[model samples]
Structures are given as structure tokens and as C-alpha cells.
Target: MTSSTPSSPLLPAFGVGTFRLKDQVAIDSVRNALDLGYRAIDTAQIYGNEAAVGQAIADSGVPRGELFITTKVWTEHLAGDKLIPSLKDSLTKLRTDHVDLTLIHWPSPGGAVPVAEFMGALAEARALGLTRQIGVSNFNIALLREAIAAVGAGAIATHQIELHPYLQNHAVAEFARSQGIHTTSYMTLAYGKVLADPVVQAIAQAHGATPAQVALAWALQLGYAVIPSSTQRDHLASNLKARQLRLSDTDLAQIAALDRGERLVNPEGLAPAWD
Candidate 1:
């Protein structure tokens, strides 16, 4: 959000999302992202492309410290015994000693394990220097409260979540802001659906930016860091330009009016919304 926030200091306002890209494609995307001035890279073990991401980061020759690298530990491996190993696997695949940030992929709502367990484990990993910062993803306010209480001092460095104008997560976002925790916004593009929205297209025409950039600009303006994924050269190039698209107050209000509570990436079996 502000320049003083945790997420703000670690990366630029926008970056690249590499969730589904894999093998040579993923590797190529990472390299291309670096070349395009994308200082942040979001990846996760569940994505199955850590090695490809790692290879590209290594070859890009961009100093490791300059690039903000992120990876996540899947919910399946959050058990005390499996946590470290999972993080190790991530490190190995990422070709880095430590990641700028690491997140819990999901809370595994219907699963038996407690949130305290993994959040505690994530704090421990942070203490052990496996990651510069640690947090959770796909967790609503209740889960976030649990995560915050569980981790205590290492209290979530950030909360990666599915946030778009449609699914305005105001309460949790407000809570995060109050506590000085940051949010990592995934699926900010509505998984390509924004490309077809008439309102977005109209706004794009007015701003002379693609719908993709308009969507990203809206999210970034609201203070959540964004990661939009793209495989094509032109899409990636245009997506990065979102950082430069500044919307006026009226434009922002139009986007705010566009919210219809449409959530595109809800994890099945999670608790109800944090109203």
C-alpha cells in the first residue's frame, strides 16, 4: 500500500504470476519477466514449476537480492514433520538459499490439522532463515486471526489472497492494514474474464490501456500488490504497463461500482466469508 508497508518495500507495485506455466515455458517466462523489469516472481510447490522458475532466475543474471522471489508450501505438507522438508524442496527447486517470502497455499478448511500447527511451523521456518518473510494465502479473516495469533511475533508478513473488485475482501483487507500486514493479490485479472467485460473495455478505451492493465491498475491502486500471469510475449509486456496506469477518482469509483461479489478462486470447503 504505502511506501512504508511490508509488501511495498519488498517488491514493485506489480509483478508476474507464474502459477500454471511450467518447463521451458515457465523458465522462459521468468527470464522474460526479468527482462521486462518485473522485480517480483510468485511461485508455489503446488504449481510444479519451481525448477523452471529457478533455472530462469539463475540464468537471468539479475542479482538475487534485487529480485523478490516467492514460493509457497502446499497445505498437504504443513504437518510439523513435513514442513521443513517441503520448504527445503522449494529452496532446492528455486535455486536460492532463502526466499523473499513464503506462503501457506491454503488453510485446508475441512482437513483435520489445526491452523495453529502450520502457522506455527511457518513462524519457525522464518526463524530458521528459510524465508525472509512468511504468511498465508486463501485464508479469510477468521483464519487470518488464527494465523496472526498462532504466529505471534512472526505474525504474517503478508496474506496472499484472491482479490478483485468483484470479490472485495474489505474486512480482511482492513484488518491487515490495521495490523500493518500486507496482502498479496492473486487472480487480480479474474482469470481472463476481465478481458470480455464491457465496463472494463469501456474503461480501457478511456485510459488507452488494455482491460488487463486496467484491472491490474485498479487492484494496485487499492494497495494490494498484484501478480497477473501471462504466457504470451505481448500479454506480459502489456501487463507490466499497469504500474503506469493511474486512474482518477471517478475511474476508481466506476471500478468500485463494478464489484458484484464474484469470486473466481474460492478453495472448496473453506469456512464462510468473513462478513
Candidate 2:
């Protein structure tokens, strides 16, 4: 149950995300990611893949001390009584005593659960050594303010959101920066939509990197942590190499221009009033 320092750096610039991968797919993907030198692995209760991810980690033989594992509390578990227990279940399924980072998957659906209730519980989880850090994902400016009020900004580790070349999410990103909260860019590739963008492809050709790398590097250059997922080892390896891909100012600007606020992860009735 021991964890790294609370003030340890924000998530690594690169990691593997297990959003939809399940069963053997999840296990193999996580195993490949670790084999390719990836230490940070992101999973969530809603993904239905925690067990598989756990199995992969156990099989990887990588030291737990060397990994940064992140999991999110699903909406149904936001209640004060359920938050910690649900996280304990996640720990069990993840086959670990404590995760490096834990996030509120989304703001309680329909505001049915107050931010104070769940955030307080999440903070309590950290105090109890159930998790090393706590954060919120898919929180807009208004929700971020409420969360900060519930728990100081310092306790809110990162605001993970759907961000990419097509949907820059400038408003939320800017707001999080002002409050000193880090942002993690999920779907940074826009679910492969951005990879086909002619601009991105051209940039990739110029750098001799894959389009996926170009997208990831752009986000990383913006100081946001990225967790792109893949089932193939070659693709996984190529994506990890994005950490070393440096984009020119011109490349950044071109990609910036591609932003049209094209968000792809919004769910009906569950989405917050976005910024």
C-alpha cells in the first residue's frame, strides 16, 4: 500500500490508456506497453478492464515502485460512502495496494452528487493511503471552481479531459493553468480522427515520425500528459517514441489552427456543462 511522494512530478509526459480495450485485448496491450518501457498506465472502473490491466502488470514483472498507475472513480461511486470502497475494489482488481493517481471519472451525472461530498471522500482516500494523489476528469471551468472550493486546488492533482488538435479546449486548459492544476489530455488523437488530418500527416513526414507521434508530441509540448492506447506492439512502441519528438513552432501553430472545438467524448445526460 506504500506509494511515492505526494509531491512527485505530475504524470509522465507519455503513458498508455486503457479506455475501451477489454479482456485479453487489455492484458496484451498493457503488457506490450510495459515491455516497451511505458511505466504509466491509465485505467478506470467504467472501462471494465481493470482486472485485465492488473493481470498484465502482474505478468510484466516490472517493479511496482517504478510504475505510475492511474485509475478513475466512476460516476456511480461519487457518493461519500461509496468512493473509498469503490476505490478499494479498484485496487483489488488492479492487483495493487495503492494507485499512484486516482481521478473522479466525471462530475456526478446531473449534479446528483455534490462536488464536496465526493472530493472530500477522495481526499480522505489519500489520507488513508488508498491512493497517492487525487484528481478530477472531464471537469469544466465551473465544476473546477466548485471542486477547488470543496478541496483546495493543491489537492486536485489533474483535470483530465478530451483534448487534441481538433478540439483544443483552450478555455478549460487556460482556467486550469491559472489555478495551478495540471491537465491530462485524453483522446489527444481525437480517436484517430486527427491522425488523418493532412496537416498532421505532412508534419509527420517532415519529422520522419508517425502521425500519432506528431499529435502526441504536440500535446506534450503544451505541457499536458498524454495517454494514447493501441493493441499492436509496433504502434505502441511508435507512440511512446513521441516523447522524443520535438515539434517546431510552425508545426505547433499549424496544428493549433486545426482546432475547431471538435469534442468526441461527450455522453448524453452524463456530460457536464462544458466550458
Candidate 3:
């Protein structure tokens, strides 16, 4: 609920991610999330549910200025000519003039499109008021370097990645921090895998919080923004409460020991060489 500065457009520390959600399910999930005090929502063109998300936002009756919405452009549309048009289509589907933040969903497969082309196009999108801020997802240290070269680090608002206890991705996160680009942790729960981990479960018990809350609190404590998705109303409400669950240094260290570099979202041909 903080204000965005000219330099760093604020991304809420916590938000709801709509990845595979679709149709009425997506709409209901978003509506429930909004009703539960979630002001930030994350979606993407590949998710195929922007319209539902937009409709939910519209039906929520929340003022546009009161919410933060982020969406990504798929890799196929990374070309300079396609980027803005795709974003315009996304805006039309999203029922907004501009999203708070927009991102390159992933690096082009086999380097089909250079980072410079898309990054520059993304900057153009911002200049044209299609989006208020620009960023990249699934980018490694090297890819981030290329993005920075395309558009100075100051122009990039955030670098979202799959960060969790199992796959800390410290190298990428550390480098991004050095550049002053915020990191958003997508799939912070490891798609529910971490929710059953004994270490996370134990920490949750000690704090009287759920394992999901422990994982989210751990990411937040590390200065990373998290977008955890869920369809169940109770789960969504409980996850939002993670903002209030502060983990102790001991708890953090214990969770840190659980890292195994277990990445769960790498797709063949689309993922970059990870750090």
C-alpha cells in the first residue's frame, strides 16, 4: 500500500498471481482476493485469462488508482513491432489504460529476439503510457546484463524469478540487487511442494502460521516481492496474513539450510542459462 516513486515504481510486498487460472474460476479468485484486501494482481498474456481478471477488477468496484496490476508479454511477441500491439491488446483485455508494471515473460527461445529489441520496445511502451513501469521475468544474471545494456538499470523496475527455499537463486538475486532492480518471487511456494516440507511445517508450527505463510514470510524477509496464486478463498486470505508473520533469524537460517537448487519451472528451449 506504499506510493510509487519516480525512480522505483512500488510493487506491493505481497500480491495474488493468476497463472493457470481461467474463466469464472479466475474471476472468482480475483474477486475473492480483492475482497480479502489484496490490492496487487499478477497475470500474463500466456495465462489466457486477462479478460477474466479485467472483468473481476471491474466488478470489484475498486477505483483504478487504488490497485496495482502487472502483466507480461509472451516471448513470441518480443519483436519490436509486436510488443506494443500485444500490450495494447493486453490492455484492452485487462480493461485498463495502463498496467502498473509490464514484463517480458521470458527470454526469446534460442535467442530468436535480442534483449535490446524487446527492452527498447518495452521502454517505448512506457513512454507511450501503455504501462507505468517495465521489467523482465525468468532472466538470469547474463540476461539481466543484456537487458541493462538495452535499457539502463534505472529504466528496469524489477526482475521477477522463481525464488523459494528450494531454489534460492542467490547469484541472480544478488546481482539484481546490486543494480537496484527489485526482485519479484513467482511460485514462492514451489507449487505447494514446500508447503509439506518438514522444515517449513516446523517453522509454521512455531509461529502458529501455515507452511505457506512461513515460505512467503521467508521471501519477504529477504527483501523479495512475492506473488503466490491460489483459488481457495481461505487459502488466499490466510496467505495474505503472511505480511504480519515475522520470522526470527534462527528461523531464517534453518530455512536457508533447506536450499537444494530445486528449480521447478524451467521449460525446454524457453529458459535461459540459469546462474
lDDT of each: 0.82, 0.91, 0.92
Per-residue CA lDDT of model 1 for 107-217, tens digit only, reads: 765756788888778878888999988878887777777887887624677788888867777777888877778887888877787788888888999989999899888
- Candidate 2 per-residue lDDT, tens place, 52-146, comes to 99999999999999999999999999999999999999999999999999999999998999999999999999999999999999988999999
TM-score of each: 0.92, 0.96, 0.96
Backbone clashes in model 2, listed as residue pairs? none
Residues 17-97 of candidate 3 have per-residue lDDT tens digits of: 999999999999999999999999999999999999999999999999999999999998999999999999999999999
Candidate 1, pairs of clashing residues: none
**Candidate 1 to truth, TM:** 0.92
Q: Give the TM-score of candidate 3.
A: 0.96
Candidate 3: where is the Cα deviation over 4 Å? 1-9
Better of 1 and 3 by TM-score: 3
lDDT leader = 3
